[model samples]
Target: MKIALIGAGEVALCLATEFCKSEDEVVVLTSTVKPSLKDLKAEIRLTDYSVENLKKNLDDCDAVVSTLSGPNEFYISAHSNILEACRQSRKCKHFIPSEWNINIEDFPDQPMFSAATHEVVRNKLRSQNDIKWTMICHGWFMEYLLPTKKNPLREIGLAWAMNHGTKVFDMYADGLQKVTLTSTADAARAVLAVLRDSINTGADLPPVTHLAGQTLTYRDLFQLIRTRDPAWKSNPVTFVEVLTAIHEGLKANDALVAIHQMRIMGFTNANHNPKGKALEWGTGILQGLRATSVEEFLDQSEAGEDK
Candidate 1:
């Protein structure tokens, strides 16, 4: 199957890297045609933000997947443009928009403008009949959950903020709120499965397929940490004060505050709001699809760092 991937961002790179090892054809459509990207195994074409170019690019492909990321307004126009192109596409049949995180439709009152734009794109997809679409309702990225030199866990924008040091520290929830997260690696695999099924079986993928590593909370994550280091401590915190601080941060135009709020939603409202049963329905749907648990991923990551 030929796949027209639109973007070269993190998610796109992950998908391209995996797809290159397969027999299927993957052509990346990017606005910036760089010299560095010239050596990639996959084909490259200029998207130039034009529908005609995208339609031509879609001519030979069986599926179109967008990993483009930008402001909500960009999505409102860009995604809709791609969908419209696919609507008139001579060959393209499957479409997966850049909806890599939690399903936006679940949280009707989500604060971020991007969520509203995603909902708009989704609604547009629903009214179409020419192409079939599916979204991976992943909770959060496991890479984001990990403490990095770039994104330290102590920054408070993490679903699991326990690796913050030995302060016997605090967090925003009482800790039983089930926070579900998945790896970009896992998500890439799921995307491949859906696309293959759509092309080969000629059947539409589920409207939404939720993916997650584990349904553990901050408290459970802290306990997992305690297993490796006995010095770790846990304490509950009032969400109101934290939310107040977040609101102030938002007013000040801090991007990190939006990240923090998303983490909060994953920890608190994820279970009830984006009510999904990835564990139940997604368990045996795909062959050998192992959804890594939080403990497994963290333990493995720590050991790798130690090595």
Candidate 2:
């Protein structure tokens, strides 16, 4: 299918890369006024991403997938413009907004990471007669916990989370929550699968989709890392320390602010846990890696293959 993807960040890049691998004609829409599409593998189009130009682009496409982000100010503005443009064009079959994160409904009181504007846009799109929409709500990225080429959290041989070698915090509960996580590749594949499936037509949509390598706590992750690397077994970070920092940050009304303050910039659960039964996806990422004890995550982070 010919699909137009909005933005060109990590998630967008991952999605476009997957679709291109599957032989889908993917067009990346940029508002750079005059974007240099030279190295981009996907077909490139330039527009201000304004409502008017967006309509023109949609006229030539079957669907639109937005990887636009809410935290990035410019991306959020462009997302709004795209919504308006999609509404005016009235040609797109499916519009997937950038929502691959913790479910908003899962957290009724926390506003730290909710996409308010995107939700509004989604509501407006659903109410319209011309377009069909679906939101991707995969939990946190598993790589966020590990070191990556893009994520510089792992430096010299160490990575950091809310805890600093003492505290045990849950991705959902107090070191017991079983939240879902997905690899960059698998998550993208799932989105493409839905887009390619003819069954996801019209207003009716899949109620929810969950992806994960395994459902375990931070302690479990620590154990995995330790089992992989021997160094982490000695001075491992504890859940108590991690939870204490998060609670203190929340008490100060600066939990989100803390993300910026940390040296390693990545998103993970603070303290509150997700409710209800979660379906697990992606058990392949954890196959050869062994970190079943507190000594595991630290050891593996220092000695395991750089995932």
Candidate 3:
């Protein structure tokens, strides 16, 4: 399919990477469009952030996927520019807006719900009657659970960034809370799938299809880590203190509710299934990369205090 992708962020790059692998023609638009899809080796058309240039380029594409990050200053503006261009393009059929996080309707009043603004943009596109739209509502990215250079796991024994000594949050199920979390690759693949066939796809207007590597809590994750490393253990904390901290932070508008809802919902939906063969394909490539217990994650390098 002839596709035009907006924004060259992680999500956009990842999706473009997968779609390119599928041998589809993709055009990536960013502040400065790279010659080819970076790191993916696909023949991607590149365009800078020029509305006039994009309109002419996208005039013949079958679908347009907006992986633009949002609810922020630049993201909103860029999408608005893209929306107007798309409205006049006359050849685009499906417009997949950028909504890779929580369900927008779940928290209509919160600005962090990024979905709200996306809905507004989507409505604008649909009103033209020339473009159909689909929204991809994925839960938290499972990859977030694993530690990265920016978000390293807590040391081995002491609490890491968590309030109190609690290893897990309250919104999590009491014991066995099973929530789905899609791997970044899986999420990208699912978006590509929706782009391929927007007409007969997932759920309603939001096109709500949840994806995940697996449905397991922090405890489940801890257990997996323990199974891999017998030296790991837990340092428990109270739910009240953590929730109070979160409430205080968000109530003061110091923090957004996106993270709060992620813990609360804990990927709880069970009926959602992952689409796109590539999502599954990528999961296998990145599997077995994590095996650290919460205790070790928090205090492994801290004061070496796991007790």
Candidate 4:
């Protein structure tokens, strides 16, 4: 099977690296080829996301997976072009949008402004039936808990919930609400499994597939960090305080508003998968691909540091 990966960010790089391990052909489409992408064993094409450019590049591809990231308008525009290109190509039937975050279905156009952009893309996908599409919601990327030197993932500005360098953390509403965390490596594997299953069984991918390496509360995460370094500290923020910050941040166009909203989401258990969908999907369709736990990741980070 031939696959086209749009964007060359951390998610796309991980997916491309994993997909290349199989006999399937992997093509990475990006505007700029970063140094990290040069090491991957895949064909790389540098092109703008214009509809014509995408259509030409997407030719003969079996499926297209987008890991594009940018401003809200940029995301919507690029995805729109990609979707149109898929339609015009007529061969690429399967598409996985760049929704590697929380389940947007539950909180449409809330918490983050980008959620509204995703809703627009979903509506466009729904309007057409030719392309089979699915969105993967794996909550937060677990690598953020570690510093850049300790993990392969690219640094996404402003670490969420905690800052390892500063040894400072934020606890939302007592820090007892559960949130799912999945490492990028595990997420890439899960996506590859889903794609393989779809190709093998000739079945449509679920609208939303959840993947979790582990689920724990903020307090639990603090304990884990403290276990690594007893000097780590937490600054508790009440529910009302988070809400107020989000409101004020939004009004001021503060870049940190998204992070504030994510804290609220975590505090309210909005980031958790209570239905065990990820577990069932993993065992039944993913075929026992075990995800790396938070504990194991910390251990790996420690080992990397020692070396």
What does candidate 3's lDDT look like per residue over 43-90, in tens digits?
355565467876877788867888777547556666666666777787
- What digit string (tens of lDDT, one per residue) describes model 4 on residues 132-247? 88988887788888876765676644336777677788787778877788888788777777877787678987788888778888899889888878989998777788779889
Can you give the TM-score per candidate against the true fold?
0.83, 0.68, 0.65, 0.91
Model 2 misplaced stretches (Cα beyond 4 Å)? 33-40, 71-77, 108-115, 148-173, 198-203, 233-307
RMSD of 1: 3.6
lDDT of each: 0.70, 0.55, 0.54, 0.80
Candidate 4 overall lDDT versus native = 0.80
Can you write out model 1's per-residue Cα lDDT over 268-298, one digit (the tens) per residue? 5553324354634254445667777766777
The segments of candidate 4 whose C-alpha lies over 4 angstroms from its true place after superposition are: 154-159, 279-282
Ranking of all candidate structures by their lDDT, best first: 4, 1, 2, 3
Q: Is candidate 2 or candidate 3 better by TM-score?
A: 2
**What lDDT does model 2 reach?**
0.55
The positional error of residue 125 in candidate 4, measured at the CA in angstroms, is 1.0
Q: Of the candidates numbered 1 and 2, which has the greater lDDT value?
A: 1
TM-score of 4: 0.91
Stretch of 10 with least lDDT, candidate 4: 150-159
Q: Model 2, 177: alpha-carbon shift in Å?
A: 2.0
lDDT of model 1 at residue 98?
Answer: 84
Candidate 2 lands at a TM-score of 0.68
Backbone collisions counted per model: 0, 33, 15, 0
